[model samples]
Target chain A: MSKVALLLGSLRRPGNGIGIASWLHPVLREGLNDTSSGTAHTGVDVVFVDPTKPPLPLGPIVDGSHVPADIRDPSKHPNPNVREFATFVTSCNGIVVLSPEYNRGYPGELKNTFDHLYWEWHKKPVLLVTYGSSGGANCSALLRSFLGGPLKMQVAEKAVAIKLPKSHSNGSDKAPTQGPAPDWLEQYRPEVLAAVAEFKDLISQQSSS
Target chain B: MSKVALLLGSLRRPGNGIGIASWLHPVLREGLNDTSSGTAHTGVDVVFVDPTKPPLPLGPIVDGSHVPADIRDPSKHPNPNVREFATFVTSCNGIVVLSPEYNRGYPGELKNTFDHLYWEWHKKPVLLVTYGSSGGANCSALLRSFLGGPLKMQVAEKAVAIKLPKSHSNGSDKAPTQGPAPDWLEQYRPEVLAAVAEFKDLISQQSSS
Candidate 1:
């Protein structure tokens, strides 16, 4: 089975990012599980990684020889969280990041996690799903630049951005009440589902090739 | 006198961001101090605000009734740091953000600071000075979007970006020794100085109007 990691980049629990991801999760599963589809894969495994639950420590400076040896060695890292997170990234064949636009950018927690490891993310097929005031286009653009430039990841061009209605509350204490998604999100659902399916196929083809 | 805040967005002290800011500080002061120029302004006062020190707590949710009264009041907040920071922001006539690019974005500390308050940032003029591997264009772009969109601040078109050589070290402990800036930075100095002067003029014009 192909293992895909769904990385939640929001620090708040009851956030739009998570709300959207909650909806996307099943869509991705169903897309991957459908054997009627012409892909050679039987089923795909999805793992949820929340940056807030097991917070990643700030990473070392990106200097070459100057980076502390312990940080360079994931096994020897002083922080167990970093080690566990690294292991999770290494296990995943593909990665999808669901991020909320905070201050018109991706949350710091997400960037911190990516900064922790370099090679672990290399060559991984990645998809971005974002929702916020401006539909998180800024966050998606920055993520694409980072993933393509420094992290050396293969990023999909077809990303999904849902412009959250002004009424949405991104509070930490409560999850958005589960219900049919808002009308704005509903309009994009088909495109988002297609993107997720295409991302899965891309991951399968890349891994098999 | 016009009060301007120099907000440094890096978590690491004695790092490249601070180093670049150190170089830019005098340039800004000189521009602001040169009263002989035609702008209708007195001397300018510059205050340094570091995001890491007296760190700001995550901001309260923007819900109308849910926002804590203390956070809304700014005076009753339990954390003196947040209160002080709010005051500093409110007192400033204009703001300049000096940030280092980390993971192809601005540091979490900077975003956290911005997240803590809303109205204080509104109507302020923000100039970005960034230094990093990609010259912090990504960070600057995201910051501009945030400041312009939700924050309701005016961002200058001409900003400064310094691309540090690969040989530079951004470790936390040691300050880069005082010396003439690298040749690449030297080449950009004139343009950066011009941008700073233009930013000061813009702030003066806006405040006066």
Candidate 2:
């Protein structure tokens, strides 16, 4: 049984990032549940780490009252939040990241989260579900480079991108009634699933070895 | 009169990004103030675009919020703050961008700002001053690619990058500060001055053309 953690990176609650993830979670759950093993993917646990959460007072950084010493070189910094996040990632077999496209890149909170803990991210299997004007493709691509190069993470090549062109608004939709997701997403779902499955298998094999 | 806008991207006021910019402003002012050649980069103006201003009305997609219609494409979506920023950038002759690196990438707000405006940014001359853990080198490269591909901006090849390692917080009497800048920025004065001068030339040429 492998456990995967889904990290949602965005300040807005009903953002496209979370909305699309909401839609995908059921599919992933159903896929894992229907597996031949008969056992469900209960192992797949998700914890949404919101950046706006109030911090525990370890020092100045957490309180936002003053600059934290750990921020200077976050990779080596020893902060409680960083430790907690790293522990969660290290415990999980895989990760699913959902983030918005800010400016031309990933949101600051996401970067701040990762910056504080680099070692935990090494060699982890991660998938990105990104959305925005350009489907956040540039942001995802830039993020992939950063993770692959410095953080040393094995980022899945097939990212799930929800560009605005495809989004249709439905009054019932969790996302701003944004219309339906694009047809390509449905068409390519199998590929993305297969990739995740393979990645899980690889992680399991490594664990056994 | 060429009006050059310095769009400060970082949220930290007294942080490295603004401090570096402040140090270089005098040099630019000197060049702009030169009386002999009225063409010495006059009509200088600096405006700091705050990233935390407010949410934009993202047209129909954003529901009640005021997102501009042109932000349909993710690549075209300016930062949420850009709805106001576009007006300033379009009216200016050139732009000097001050950015900080987070997790080996541009701060989310900085990227968000660019995501909002589309056509207003085309053909603008951008002088990059990126500072971070490793002097923001990787971020600088990624930014160049982004601006070149989508924004269609003339990104100056010569950028001023201040590696965090080189920063000097304490001024020693033995080693007096050399450049026109204050003591803290003595280490990075050369690159800083060079970038500003180069930016002045780029803007002057573009404004005349």
Candidate 3:
């Protein structure tokens, strides 16, 4: 089984970034073209990396006779979550970054996560799935150069951008107050499906070779 | 005096971004070519916008017979700092953004401040002064598009990039731990002066017209 990491870039809850990913997670798991749904997107497991998840307990890992001793091993990170986060990335066959372009740039938390680990990123295939008012065009372009050039990662050609409409008009230009449009998921289904398929294909080739 | 906003993007204190800005602040105040040292930069007032400043006190504005009643005015923002920040931006004739490329992007706090106020940014001349290993090339490019396009702000032609030498060799690609080379300020002095001169010229025209 090929495991893929779905990294959440934005912290906005019920926003378009997470909303779109939630909508497509189950759909992609059943396989895009398979008319009869089977278990998991053709044996591909996606690990959702959300930073909001409660941090690991401060105490030592629970000891058990059945547990592997190395399960408690956390590389060398001062923060347990950061150590686990990096370790989890090593297990993934591919990665899909769900980032929302904020102020024509990507989020800081996303960069914070990427900076924690280095060697695990080399030659790993990454698919950019971004959402924003401009469909995250600038965000995707910058990420492409950074991932492909500096990190030497295999960035997928099928980069997806889910553009959300401008619906907020409260006279202030902060964040959008409301959630996404009612049918945003239905409208962007095809794009999401296509991007996920490309990611699966890349990892599949990696495993086979 | 033509007021300019120097917005600091990165929080690193001894780092290049702030170090370069600190070096140029006084030099610009004295004017580049003038032999006589002046108190201000050719009638241009540069405001340093750092997010780490203490927040405005919760109490009401100090009441005094001699003081203006509205001096304690903070617009409509729930966060007092944000309100004061936006209010202050409106008074500036031009802006200088001091940013560093983090993981190939920019600091989140910078974007958070920009997103807070929209109308204040319209037609405001902005000079991008960025520091990174790539001399903030990608960061400057992205900000140029962002400020010129959506924000509808005036972007300076001479964007300054104080490229720092890659000295952090602790095997982590995260952030440059050490400060810039001892002579980095002297090395990048000419470029920063040129950019600030261009910014001064733009704001001079704004005040004259």
Best by DockQ: 1
Order the candidates by lDDT, highest first — what do you get? Answer: 1, 3, 2
TM-score list, all predictions:
0.78, 0.69, 0.72
**Where is model 2 more than 4 Å wrong at Cα?**
A1-3, A8-19, A31-42, A47-93, A99-113, A116-124, A130-138, A157-183, A202-209, B12-15, B35-39, B48-83, B164-184, B187-194, B205-209
Interface RMSD of structure candidate 2 (Å): 7.0
Model 1 CAPRI quality: acceptable
Native contacts recovered, in order, as a fraction for each?
Answer: 0.26, 0.21, 0.12
- CA lDDT of each candidate? 0.69, 0.58, 0.61
Candidate 3 residues B1-209, lDDT tens each? 56676777765444455556666566555453332431224556666665566331112211111112113343755556656766787788888888876556555455545655566777787888787777878778877877788688888798878767666211122233344435654676667677666766666566566
Off by over 4 Å in 3: A32-43, A54-74, A78-81, A165-184, A207-209, B1-3, B32-45, B54-74, B78-81, B103-109, B166-184
Best by TM-score: 1
Worst 10 residues of 2 chain B by lDDT: B168-177
* Clashing residue pairs for model 3: A29-A41
lDDT tens readout by residue for model 2, B32-65? 5554443465557655444444332221122213
Worst 10-residue lDDT window, candidate 3 chain B: B61-70
Q: Candidate 1 lDDT, tens digit per residue, A1-209?
A: 68888897775534565667777777677766766653545578877765545534444323332332225455554446666777777778889888876666766667756766777777888988887767888889888988877788888778988777766644333324378755666688677766766676778777888
